[model samples]
Target: MSSNAELHTLKQRTDNYAYVLRCRETGLCAVIDASEPDSVLELLARIDGRLSLILNTHHHPDHTAANPELVARTGAPVLAAPWSGHAGSGPDITLKDGDPIILGRLRGTVLATPGHTLSDLCFWFEADRLLFTGDTLFSMGCGRLFEGTARQMWASLTRLRALPADTLVLCGHDYTLGNIAFARSLDPHNAALLEWEATVRARKAVGALPPHPTLGLEARANPFLRADDPDIQKSLDMPGADPSDVFAEIRRRKDHFTA
Candidate 1:
C-alpha cells in the first residue's frame, strides 16, 4: 500500500460530514457515510468516479440516508454493522470489531465503539494513521448517550484515547464550536483550550472550520477527553472522583448547554 491514500471531507446538511478515501496511485476509492447520495455521487465523479465500497459508521439516518440510493446507482457493496437499521437491506459485508475492509491496496480496520448507538463503529486506517470516528468521539466532545450508558460511553472514549497520539481523527459532525463553548464553562483556565476556541471562532466567523484537530490536540482541548483532569474535576466539585462518574456529570451539563 503506497502511503498515498488521500481523504476528502464532504459536508451534508448543517453538521454532518461524509468522507471519501482515495488511493492516489490506483484511483480506487471508498466512500464513508453517505449522507446525501446526490452530493456523494457528484463528489465521486470529481474524484476518479470509481466507488468500490460504502462504509457506514453507524445506522443513523443522517449518516446512512444515502446508502441504498448509492448502492442502487453504483452497485457498490455496502459494509456496516448488522445492527445498523439504516444499512438498507443489510450490508453486503457485515463488519465486526478488528475486521479489515480492503479497497485496492488500502485497508480500513473496524473498531466497535458502541455509545451513541449499540452498533456504532469507527474505521481506522492504520497504514494511513487516520481514524474516522463516527459519532462516538468528535472534535472536542463525544456523542450523546442515546442508547448506551454513561459507563459504556466512558469505556468507549478510553479505548480511543489509547490510540497513537499522532493519529488523525475525522469525526461525524461539525460541533467544535458548541463543544468548545461547553468545555470553557468547566476548564476556563486552560490556555490551549482558550486559544483553540479563539481560533475555531475566527474560522466559523469566516464560514470555514479549522483543520481537524489531532488526537494529541483534542486530549488537551476537549474536556470530555479530560474528564479526569484536576481542573475539570474540581469545577464539578468532584475531586478524586472516578473518571466515568466525572464523565457523566460533564455529559449532563453539556446536554443542557445553550451554545
Candidate 2:
C-alpha cells in the first residue's frame, strides 16, 4: 500500500532546532514545533497543502516562541500537554498519555515521556514510524535534567528505543557532531562513533544537512544507549551491568564534561 503522506523537514542552525511538516495528498498538512515562524511559513507557503495544525512537544520557549504568530497566520489548533501551561487564545488542545489526535486524514498518538522537563511530551506517528522527541532525546545524547530525574529520562529513552527499528527520529536539535564528540570521549574504541563523526564533518563542510530522522537501529550503535557494553562501563568507571544505570551515569559525565 502506498502512502499519500509525505514528511517535510526544515531545520535551522541558530539554536540547532528543527520543524517538521507532515502533508497528506488530500490537501491537508500539519507541522511539529514552529521554532522559527518565518522559516516555517516560507516552507508552508511553498508546499501545496492546507495548514491544519501545530504540534508542540514541550512548553520550552525556543520550541514554542513562534506558536502565537503561526497560529494567527494559519488559524490552526495548538496541541500540547495539559500541564504545559501553554494554552494560547488560538484554540488549545491539551493531550495526556494515551491520548491520540485524529485529524481526519492524519493520526498521532501522544506519549508522556517527561524527563528533559516535567511537561515534556513526545509524539509517535505510527504510520510514519516517526518520533518527535523534543529536547528529551537528542542525536547521540539526551536532554539535561532540568525538570525531571535521570531515572525518568532513562525510562523515557528506553521506551523510545523499544519502538520499531525503522522508526525515524525527528529530534529537536542538530547536535549530531557535538554529541559524537562526547560519545568518543566516553567510548574511545567505538568504531561507530568515529565513523559517525566523520560523516557529520563531511556534511557540514559541504553546507549540507546531516541525515536526521535518524533510524532507531543506528542509535543502538550509540554509546549512550549501549550502557550495558563492558567497554563503556569500564570507561566511565561504572561497575553496574544495567543499561539504565549506565545511561544515567553517562548523563552525569556529560553534565560534568560541559561544566
Query: What C-alpha lDDT values do all the predictions have?
Result: 0.85, 0.74
**Candidate 1 runs further than 4 Å off:** 1-3, 84-87
- Candidate 2 TM-score, C-alpha based: 0.89
Lowest summed lDDT window (length 10), candidate 1: 83-92
Q: What would the per-residue lDDT of candidate 1 be over residues 1-259, giving only the tens digit for each residue?
A: 1368888888888889898888886777888886888888888888765888999888888888888888889899988898644345777888999998787778778999988988889998878878899899998899999899888888888888888888888999988878888888887778988888888888878977566778888888788888778878999999999999999999999999996
Cα deviation at 32, candidate 1, in Å, is 1.2
User: How many clashing residue pairs, candidate 1?
Assistant: 0
For residues 1-259, write the lDDT of model 2, one tens digit per residue: 0275677767754745656454455667777776778887887777765677788888777777788887889898888885434543422888788898665466779998888888788888787677788887777877887988877887887778777878877788887877777887877666666777777788889988776635553455566566766778888787666777788888887887741
- Write out the backbone clash pairs for model 2: none
